[model samples]
Target: MTFGGLPTRWEPPGASRGVALVAPGRSYPPTAPLLDFTRVALLQHGFTVQQIWWDSLTRGEEEPEAWVRRHVAAAHAREDADRVLVVGKSLGTLAAPYAAERGLDAIWLTPLLTDPSVAEAVGANAGRQLLVGGLADALWDASVARELEEGGCQVLAVPDADHGMGTRGAVRTAEIHLEVARAVEAFLAGAAAGAGA
Candidate 1:
């Protein structure tokens, strides 16, 4: 799909309660194995995945916040989408919440939250959102994680791994898949249930 002059890939349509928007990292394509693995994981947990590639942002070329608004509008067009969830890895995380600000829920993976000025551009309450990352991720620090939590997001720290959580290749493990699936299921269900409260 083309949104705001950018290209995005949508997963083959499947059974899902909502639409999931995944923004991939700079070093890899949307179809990279790690992203593919994560996409499948989200599918196994009943999410239909759509990916937006913003690799240019890392090179100081693209404006992620602007891209985010376009994709969020795209997700909103999906039938029966009461809520859209924006999920991102690394640089994409900086943009994901920008969409969330427009009323979609967002999930950040090994995110690096930049200055408040940028965060404010995303939305007033944008920083107060869910974030997930591995404990061993070098891209993030504890203080940043705490700031996100303080802003009101529920942060889930994956143990013993880096940004993509490949410690011993957990991506291929049935146990790890189950764990991630459960966490996502619970998080979405809870978020849905709490939408008005």
Candidate 2:
């Protein structure tokens, strides 16, 4: 997706601890539940958030890595946030390297493990990052996920869930979402604390 549009900025009063930049997946709205939940979590942990604007490019069009890099890096630099946390999904996993180079932590949802560069960037990032993916996802790699875990990444591998972390039935989907929320909350909390430390 092309990084175009106005960012949704949220600054909680007295927020002094850190900041978060949310990068969303291709074709997904920036107001997705995942981003909403993360915004609240970050606010509760005293972090300001900027939900980056996104508009998907044509399928045959190349993913705009340079555009993403310029925007994310510029935003991060402008904020001068000490304890930065990046949250992304699917194609947004492209930001891993930018975050990594800045020594920042991140949470990657439905990461593009099919891309060696994405996997390597996520795996090599210094902090103990969090990854969420389902076995049914075409882009997911269980071996690579395991390897990432072994190398300090935390993975939440869901059974029978697809690329969007969705299953067949409504009940199962809700269950998976609940589990994801719990994991994300814990991960963000821990990372914020660690950054404070």
Candidate 1 lDDT, 85-158, residue by residue in tens: 77766666666546655655676666765445334433345423566666677765656667667767777766
Model 2 backbone overlap count: 0
- lDDT score, candidate 1: 0.60
Q: How well does candidate 1 match the true structure in TM-score terms?
A: 0.63
Q: By TM-score, who's the top model here?
A: 2
Residue 119 CA error for candidate 1 (Å)?
Answer: 6.1
* Per-model C-alpha RMSD: 5.3, 3.1
Q: Model 1, 99: alpha-carbon shift in Å?
A: 2.3
> How high is the CA lDDT of each candidate model?
0.60, 0.79
Candidate 1's error at 80, in angstroms?
8.1
